[model samples]
Target: MDIQQQLINAGQYLKANQLAWGTSGNLSARLDDHHALITASGTYMANLKEDDFVTFNLQTGTYEGTRKASKETPFHTGIYRVRQDAKAILHSSPFYTTLFACSSETIISELFIETMYYLEDIAYVDYYHPGTQELGDAIAEKANEANIIMMKNHGVVVFDDSISEALMRIETLEMACRMILKAKECGIKLNLIPQEVVTSFLEDSKYKPRKKKGENFQR
Candidate 1:
């Protein structure tokens, strides 16, 4: 509804958490069924405003707004195309997610319950040059399994209906990554929670939306 305000809030949160610096991160919120408002390319996260966001058509998938959408938009668009439930997407290069992102394997959390609840498992899509079809395809494949994904050697990407929830997911992911890094300092094996526990936790809390697909925006 209020896309600009949403951008402002997300930008502020990014600044407060140090998740982004200069013009490094981007965020987007669905404007209607067929359109989303995304941060324009090259906009600094520390001082972002509503006007800094641009509109992109969902079906045709083009930004018609005065300002250009983020260059990494294909990454965001790929997720949106695959996840009908996702209303907001956030892309950031936080220190730890970036650290784990560069790993050969996909990062999974055995450390935090929040990680289990927010993201059953984090997916890792191997490096593909940004804004490319290959990257989008790899990312979309992962989107089917999880909402939070670590782009190989890139950063982290998150999707959820509410921008607030998506932002929280990013925070949780960073915290878990930080803990893993800290524990590694002691040479102790990280005790990750079992898959059974994560499954049970998800069963305990489930959301059945009244409307799975909102009205698709049209030209």
Candidate 2:
């Protein structure tokens, strides 16, 4: 599929899964080393059209076409600039994930197999005003260390070599957050998988192969 259609499909899928709502999020795919296609400002992810996206210059922080790029363009470009493996990025405020982002709670990635893989190396960026260069710079500083970055009091940003993998990571994050909140609410003590076990699974398990940079894990 074309990049535009891929992003549209991702948007619709996110809407169907309740990972995104209304015009509160943005999605982008790297078009090349120097340019990206990002959802236009104020466009609803659930109903994105081809015209709803703008071609943004990653190096110049400029855009082509008529529509304005999403206000969060700085971070999108920043991630691409820092991480050459990043092909697609998804930024959204899902209920559970956003709740966790806004709270003082910490997430335990060793909770399960999926969490160990997807939530591994999550980075936190202290609260910065959305759309500001400071926020973008903060995210970029930690972009090389993680695939998922949580913006305190704002939302989460996930990126991977393919849009599908990016969506998978965000979905796993939301599920983990929901489980954590529910367990806390019920006063249930959750047993975490040991770090050694997690490391073993990541390194030796046959269930999933290690992900190499620039490999597309699109489903």
- The 10-residue segment of model 1 with minimum total lDDT is 210-219
Candidate closest to the true structure, highest TM-score: 2
Those runs of model 1 whose alpha carbons end farther than 4 Å from true positions after fitting are 205-219
Question: Per-residue lDDT for 176 in model 2?
Answer: 96
- Candidate 1 Cα lDDT to native: 0.77
Instruction: For each candidate in the order shown, give its overall lDDT on alpha carbons.
Output: 0.77, 0.91
Candidate 2, run of 10 with poorest lDDT: 210-219
Off by over 4 Å in 2: 212-219
Q: Model 1, range 61-179, lDDT digits (tens) per residue?
A: 68986888888888778778778888899888998878888776345565666766675556677789877878877887778667787887889898888988888889888888777
Clashing pairs in 1: 33-217, 34-217, 110-192, 110-193
TM-score of 1: 0.86
Which candidate should be chosen as best, given lDDT against the real structure? 2
RMSD of each: 4.9, 3.6
Residue 168 of candidate 1: its Cα lDDT? Answer: 80
